[model samples]
Target chain A: MSDAKTAIDVNALLQAIPYARFLGITVDQRGNEITTVLHFSQRLIGNPVLPALHGGAIGAFLETTAVAQLAFEFAGAGNGKVVLPKPIGLTIDYLRSGKPVDTYGRAEITKQGRRVATVRAEAWQEDRSRPIAAAHGHFLLQVAEDAAAS
Target chain B: MSDVDFSPEDLMTMKDVLIEHVPHAKAIGLKVEDVKLSEAWLSVAYSEQLIGNPETGVIHGGVITSLLDNACGIAVQLTLPGRMSIATLDLRIDYMKPATPKLDLMAHTHCYKVTKNIAFVRGTAYHTDEKDPIATCVGTFMLAANRAQPLPTTSKAATEAMKILAQKKGGDA
Candidate 1:
């Protein structure tokens, strides 16, 4: 409910996750809608000839963002242990070619169920109308009870 | 902030960059199908190299993600011109079913829109059995403004080595 109290230091949280550290993703802002930034670098290339960005790299960024979003929400709740949500399913819509640059993405929590959490995210660069891509994800939540009981 | 400066060929070819650089993409033999200014499609032929759990002869989730990531980049390049460097802001993938070994993976992508500094795109990945997708992904990429040209990394070689090691470990196990 309150994103502020549970607000995670984006840099600290991302650094904690090795993969996030690899992508160089940083939390741009913290709240109900968690905003993050992925700095484009040489590490994310998919093709050499045309120099397009890689899809897996993008996917990793998206998946990481989803986890961070849930973490933010859990922190807001202030009563549960920080749990890592594993992505059970996801649907990606590739709208355009992602150039080699610093791309910004924003994610929103659509529904946070007891066991499953649904999230929607849109990415943009210089233009908003033309989004680089959009993603919806299903994350399996790890709750304090589930952990303690285990 | 204004407009990207790349040709259709550049846009399509950019997707190739993903295949060439990313370690997993190389392991799966990802290849481009076609590239237009505003639209692109690509595919990968199933091979022994793509297998994860060899007993089941299923493709690995890493391979599927590679295919979808390349497709999403192509979708963005289709609309933007002239080498606009983009990074994945976020990406979500759904593994509808397990991909069989030796099957062809086709990925189709389109750019939704391109604005001042942001771009939107979408795509789907399927196999010979076009009705079903081994996995589907949606991603959001943002335009990196004031970003310099990309520097080439020999990172793939290290990744390739790791894959080989993994294969050997799998075999031993």
Candidate 2:
């Protein structure tokens, strides 16, 4: 982790992904960790009877947060530019039902190399200790050549 | 567990009800295409709202995940004896390739196994050619003990149709 934090417009970066906008995902960066938030909405409900948040929605939120965290780290690395990381594979485990409420998520970069990166993410509504779901995935990092050309 | 003798028409009505009740599925424009004893096919039309990368005009991976998840759940429902609530326990998906822009996506899912409380599923999503899939998924769902209420029928005829189809299946078997 870099001790020096770079000035990056996290909102603008998230806005680039249109689906993030649809889900109303927001970011909160304090120290070294970046927290993602998804406010409750009727459109995000999957089981109307339980009024539980859609499993897909939770998966999407975690994936998006992981991608955003990587982009943020890349921007801080030097060039201050963000590139979209392509997801290769994702595995999510649902620990509990996501009650309809404002959900929070955080992603940790387990490994980062020149071409690939691995991220682990978790989401929770009320208590961080009790996560509703957790996801870990591998992504193809944007190489310097592609970043420079773009 | 009692076996459910469901005809083709009865399965179709059940699919319609399931899709209609799942708000997220309805919002994503997911439609059940076909349903059999332990398998199902679902389709999602291309929409601008689902675009993840505006530059390439490709739909988001999340949309594909949602479709696959829902498809697997539907397959699990078909495999069970009667109406029961089910929740996804875990899902793993591998993106083989980016989806074709402006093209609809389809998922074919099968419930491979069912235990007392768990149902396992496998599925594939494709754009046009079934041979070339965009993604593949395997998942597990936990079945609730209580019987779930049937989704509201779109028409009285649909309910009647299901009864007739059930009768036909019972007679044939």
Candidate 3:
């Protein structure tokens, strides 16, 4: 769906989501992979002693990235504007404590069906190979026309 | 870590320090409703700032995850014999439904199992009815060996206020 008529600006779509803006998540296209970044902010820290980034923030970043990925990839399939997928479930594994630093995330769409999608996301700070956390999530995909008809 | 002596009062004080020092907790306006031996309850008041979807007005799932994480950590702390730090190792959350907008959400967590270095926790988030929860989580936390520094003692007036509040709540500490 890379045709000119079907192109969609994923960043603009992300910005429309209030929580994505609240978390200060930004998206960039590196070739075909979509990278999501969460800039360091004191307001995102959960453990003051370790000064670690809140796990929830990292999880949210990954989840949002996955949703953005689905929206970007399947932009033209749905009628009208892209319908953002709703999270069905999320499982995050904290591989290490997230240091208080800028974090990056990317999601792999393992499966994309008509009504559901499964995504696996990883987040890292400083080193991409050594992710601080990884998450697997399933989201319910909605077709805009179906949504409007319902 | 060797078990150290601590009173129920000390744990309560630690909870206050935790909620105050954690920047995100403060940003989300989380409050400790109660803490017992191996359990804790936390609440976050409804605020527009926390809304994830402007169209729905429901608070973000991230906020609920943070609340459950904090509550689980607090439960682990309460189970520990002394003040010691803990970090989340893994957390799995199943969103049962969207939380009702404009209602204070509460999370109740319990540390059901503990070993030398690991604690298992389960938590539920709800608004009015506990039976009908908005989300549920199961997580594991790692207990660090180093003892945590005690929270600074409160001022006399603050202590008196805490005591009065405790009494009013029919608590014996």
lDDT of 1 by residue, A51-80 (tens): 455667565666666667778777645274
Instruction: Please report, in order, the local distance difference test score of every candidate based on alpha carbons.
Output: 0.63, 0.82, 0.79
- lDDT per residue, candidate 3, A85-142, as tens digits? 7787889999987876789988889998888899998999899999999999888887
Superposed Cα deviation of residue B58, candidate 3 (Å): 2.2
Q: Please identify model 3 stretches exceeding 4 Å from their true place.
A: A1-5, B1-8, B145-173
How high is the TM-score of chain A in each model?
A: 0.87, 0.91, 0.92
Candidates 1 onward: DockQ, in order: 0.13, 0.33, 0.31
**Lowest summed lDDT window (length 10), candidate 1 chain A:** A44-53
Q: Least lDDT summed over 10 consecutive residues: which range in candidate 3 chain A?
A: A1-10
DockQ-based class of model 3: acceptable
What TM-score would chain B receive for each of the candidates shown?
0.70, 0.82, 0.80
Model 1 global lDDT (CA atoms, 0 to 1): 0.63
For A97-146, candidate 2 gives per-residue lDDT tens digits of 88767899989899998788999999998899999999999998885568
User: CA shift at B85, candidate 1, in angstroms?
Assistant: 18
